[model samples]
Target: MAEAIVDLVAQGLLDEGTRLPTERALAQQIGVSRGTVVAAYADLADRGLVVRRQGSGTSVAAGRRTPVGRHLRNDGFTRQVSGPAVAIDLSLAAPVYDDVVARLQANTADVMAAGAAPHGYTPLGLPALRHAIAGRLSAQGVPTTAAQVLVTPGAQGALQLITAAYLRAGDRVIVDTPTYPGALELFSRAGAQVDGIPRDHAGPRPGHFERALADGEAALAMFVPTCHNPTGTTMSERRRHELLAAIRDHEVLMVEDLTMADLSFSGEAPPHMVALAPDRIIAIGSFSKVLWGGLRVGWIRADPATILRLGRLRTAQDMGSGLLDQAAVLAALPQLDEIIVGRRRLAQEREAVLRAALTEQLPEWEIGRCDGGYGLWIKLPQANAAQVVNAALQHGVAIAGGGVGSLDDQHLDHVRVCFTLAPEILVEAASRLRAAWQQVCADDGTTTILAAV
Candidate 1:
């Protein structure tokens, strides 16, 4: 079976690049049909646990890292260096809160004194943390209860739980044309067929969504309506109602991501989709964007039945989220509003600096307007985004190309740059990015030059 091979690879019994036995031979040895073995090998290949070649047989994969590790390493969250000794990482969209560690330390004594679980197994999340999450949602107009909340390591983890519980192999998933890369990867890993809907700055198009759901091909839809990731476009209240009407007629499920909702530059998030249709929407939120990514605290709010089902699925995977993480999130809840205010101000200031720098250095590029969120989605004039990204790395700056967030690779001419750094760094990054852009253009037989910034 696929799981047996996975266990062998995980336990180091089957080394990386080890050649797997031929399907027929293994099938005969194990006394199973050759067809069953073939299916198992196909499943392993799909999960990236094995590699299949044209002439060579299947072999163990080279590296099988966790999703979080892969995300951080491959998605520009971690600054990778090759040519430069120091690289300015503009890939991560997370805000850096300097005092969060101290705040967590200050609350650690109380958390410890109150006594964490002896076995540390709170499957549905710590009671106090659940209540705090529920209260936070209630204040946001969702009217949630602790019984309807389930905690996970982060928004990514919550998505994993939902995918495991609700999505099955071959299920159809509807998403935006260029949505969160992590969500797209997760849904694909669950073997779901992804379909995209076009957008025009008002979030996903409602008619496209309705049509996609009309055929009953899509089992569920994923959306980031407020301060949407990569694009930073918030859906208008009218569009929200339109989508709700579509969902009502189609009776399809929706997964709403509120990860970056609270980071709005206006210091106020829009009304949650779950508020309009709690029974139909499964909402995911995280303290990673608001408090700190290191806290690894996130929650899900849904009907009690869905919550319980997800909780059981989460328990089966890992007993529960870390007790200390839950405690830290609970401690920070009281002052979360003030923290969000500071973050919004910081994002606004940094975005302005980044925009000014990009305008001065890469004047030909089209900079998309962002009302909230941490990054700018930029459209290149004539150069390829992937080439520019590579040249930027050589110039000591790291950024993400639009293909990283695109579902169908249609955004190859664009890039997403985070403005979470200081003003001076933003200015310097723009200078380096300009040089990279020029290099890419020149490589493409275009002679372009720009004055020094």
Candidate 2:
């Protein structure tokens, strides 16, 4: 069996850099003894088919193209797929649709039927949809009409449109450190220098942000005022008002991202900053969470002049958001309260399960007190989060978090474990994780790094 595992890798049949199964999982899959799998790994290491690092466990050599395994197939194609086979996908912050999803599906044809005209290149958006968006924002507090709304494909597109309009190369932008990773990447891609502001449990650190603004480099700031990503911190109204006043004084553009705000995990939704500082805030919202993600729909509520600029940019990017999706989301808006109630109940239940499970299984680690959102940010005791993640992957329990940068001292200690997985898979994944931790912290040197991190 050991010789067979080595022979498969030697033949260039498996793709380079694909994850391999754990000794236990491989043994079960192959109907062989766990000892046989360990011997197979030892044999493979001797031939340099894989490198067995002390802390990192095992991985294929960079040049190795294949491995000897029943799963390996050599039909060369550029079809790259990456996802976890674990029972629960606690990785992505996904919301279940249930009634909302079915209702939208049934009424999708109605929307298409209504907007069944030649919408080839209307720059701003459909008048009815824009009006609906404007109405929604006004209801939320940032009073606006259709003239102030510019519909985009998604929150991402809305971001790009705003960035293109106001940002340029060498421009300085202020962002909260460890905020949405995707938005951070977008800022970098748009050619701007990003300065991170320190944030606490309350909200963005006002002292740090004011200092950044005082530096006179930053002309814009992006913030998540409600249920921030990863941390799940909600910025208090007082804190938001102070920040907005500072932005107003500094003549800075404030971009508000409220994609997850509507989830209302705790029934206390923070006031939208756009309501208080409508003049300086560019508010972006999306239906990806409330509705289905497949619908590429999101909206921006800004000053009419800003909307005009975004309208031209929207024309160049892509005509407008899907008419069908816009209609479906409009229909779901009235049912928004019902959806939030169900989602919050489910999220709370999941959180409770996760908290109890962590207490019973991983007593040493401290779970973040995030009452909202899809996952928990766990602080492990003497464990490398990334090292643990790579190890967990082989054990068939995929997690989220990796190295932030080459120079970053690994953030493996702060991993975000999603509670969205089912109970059985969650238990199995946690148990397998306990097993992986033993291997990761077994050695003195790796254990030391784990301690320091």
Candidate 3:
């Protein structure tokens, strides 16, 4: 029992100010004697890992030290890939929004009239919008309530609030490798030690999560289970269950980013982690993908208390999300079902075009079929992806190298290309990419050989 407490503390699982279970309760849960737990507590206290106060339960010691290191900043990578302003930019994951923009434009009058407050400063967001978002989530089986919803400027803002509210400088955050670079940057900026768990084609393995929890400390785990960014992979329902179980057992907070959940082309939306572990998981969502990036509406769904705390944190940052944007999203929510159907169809068509274009132009590249999301992860056989990105830019195309999306620089041979563009543009981008590849091979003084699929 003493070893368990130490391990939890070392891993950053048991955060400061968190009360431990009573000796009797802990002993009962672990099938150990009360005296054994008492001894364990005494040992932990002696080591200054925990503090036991009279009438107050044992809690982890504050001011524990954690090592800090510099991490690759996502914004820097974004600027590197997007700064040149190429004609067809595949470096960022902006969604295709022609249809949604038209719909919103047609209803602009209704959205403008829906706003009750003239000044448009809603610190906790528009109540009507919160209710609309909550209703949509509840319909999706997440069992959310309006009071538990807090609107933010975007999913990135919601993430900032969450990290500010829950994470301290020395906390440990576990994230999957090849995750959204923005998320990695946020965690690193928060002064948290970011640990990466390698993922497969399906997603992060649940068994790896269990091992990570047992071997290290984590204050929270962030997952993009549905239509994962960069890789465009979705987690199987069974894997989500296993991962949720691990989170429950370890008592670590879970942050689920569902920004691309509605854009799934496979027509299969797995049960939300919040549905299974409402008290533990805080889900972040945005309208940037389904509706329009310019809208900049996003939200957080969690327990009411957590929502309240996040609201306060948000209030401290800026007054609140734009009321006009909130009203626009509210006006658009009723049409969500129809909108998603169209978006999914278009996404599928785009995916197909991207696949064929890559096959025709860069036959040596290994690409996976994405069932959802906006991008394709292409593996280069020989060329360095960063070098390829630079070369592609010179050819008037921009793309994100895999190392830009990963916690470590492990995926140097891969690149992520966004397909959320017009078919003609995608085809042109692929042609330019091939040119970049040939240039890289020439620079390396190596023959470019196409690999058999």
Candidate 4:
């Protein structure tokens, strides 16, 4: 038997056009039987990979040949190509990874080693972990029970479960465009129509949501009240009340994702719209940013009946989040305050460096009015963000470019610079960005300016 089979094209180590040696040649060289090589080929065939033809040798599959920097079709829409290898990266919105994550992962493995594979499916989740989560939420005065909390893989999974439980094909789900990119994909996969409302700087545009809901067919609306993504805007308390009243009047179920709330740079959080309207809201919270991305632990706060409905639908997706991820998150919660403090420090320093650089170097650029969140949404004097990003990447810096920042590509001239890099890295990043911006300005002498004055 062969010892192992490797993905031949994994790192371009096996170049796309190159072919592996014949099974007889490989077996003879490695001292393994041809039967083993045959088993390895069978594994490759099972993966929908490789092409085999009668009287012809096998060739590389079509799947692995996707261009290294081509547009990726993720959820539904196709995203533009983002060049890899950069001196600076301001494209990703994720928090920086550090030692705390490693420590938690070490602890997670210890627990799993204790008792990993139990009897048939711990579907609802590990009981001790669920109880810990419930007890934690109750401390927030959100009125949760262990039975009311169903641990999904992430807030993403919880959202899917809720959509699966409530929606049929062709039902309309409301979204604020420039909303969470993943949620847009989730709604698409569920076969639900997304009624995208325009978003203003402070969450959804006033009365825009009202018009979308006017058609009584809208069944659900998802909102990110605290630390809304992309724009770094939060819905005000007054607007929160208005949003609740509007959704209640329309009888629309609200799904609020508070994924980034813990990183609020302002330290001020509005009362969760969910807390204000419990009967109408399904709240999803995550440890992805607060703890670590690999943790992938998130909880859903819903009615007990809603939880039971989710439990039945949960098996269709995953067995539940891994037990050790839950155990690690629970262990990390008491130290959660420490983690948040470290994160706040990192965010504050990075944002300050970015702000200082923008003010001193590129003073003419328009930075949006943001009180909280991890990204800086700024507009160039005349540069097309998409074009600028292309030029900037070639010059050794990569910035996130999209009109998807605001509803309907309204900010097509703008770029979103994520400020979640480590402090030292962020300083060097800003220096490179200053150079990139200069190059972008040089490349755009013919373009007319979009003047705010």
- Report lDDT per candidate: 0.81, 0.68, 0.80, 0.68
- Candidate 1 residue-wise lDDT, 1-453, digit = tens: 775675566457888899999999999999999999999999888877789998899998887521211111234422333334446888878866587556764355545543556666888888777888898889888999989999899999999898888777568888886788888777766656677788887778999998889866677899999988888878888889999999888788899999999988987656889898888899998988877777888889998988888888887899888877788777777788888898899889999999999988888889997989899999887538888888998898888888766654577788999998889999999999988888888888886656554
Give the deviation of candidate 2 from the true structure as CA RMSD.
Answer: 12.8
Task: Provide TM-scores for the models.
Answer: 0.83, 0.74, 0.81, 0.75
Per-residue lDDT tens digits for candidate 3, residues 1-453, read 665565465457778878999989999999999999999889767656678999998988886434322234343365655664677788777775576786674243554465445565667788877888899899888988889998898898889888888786667898887788778767765657777788886679778888889877788899999999879888888888888889989989899998999888977878988887888899999988888878889999988888887887777889798776777777787787888888889888988998998898888899975869888988988649878988988898878888766754567788899888999998888888888898999999888874343
Whole-model lDDT for model 2 versus the true structure?
0.68
Tell me how far candidate 3 lies from the true structure as C-alpha RMSD in angstroms: 13.0
Top candidate (lDDT): 1
Which of 1 and 4 is ahead in lDDT? 1
lDDT of 4: 0.68
Q: lDDT by residue for model 2 over 1-453, one digit each (tens)?
A: 643444454465544555568888998997989998888788666645677766666777666432121112211010114442554345566665465577774254555544434644556666667787888777777789988888788787788888878876557888776566556555554546567776777788888888999997675799988877766667888899888878877888889998878766777776799888777788997877666666678888888888888887777777677776776777677787787787777777877777776666667777877857777777777547767766666666666652231012334466777766556666666777666666666733453222221
Model 3, poorest ten-residue lDDT window? Answer: 65-74
Question: What's the residue-level lDDT of 248 in candidate 1?
Answer: 87
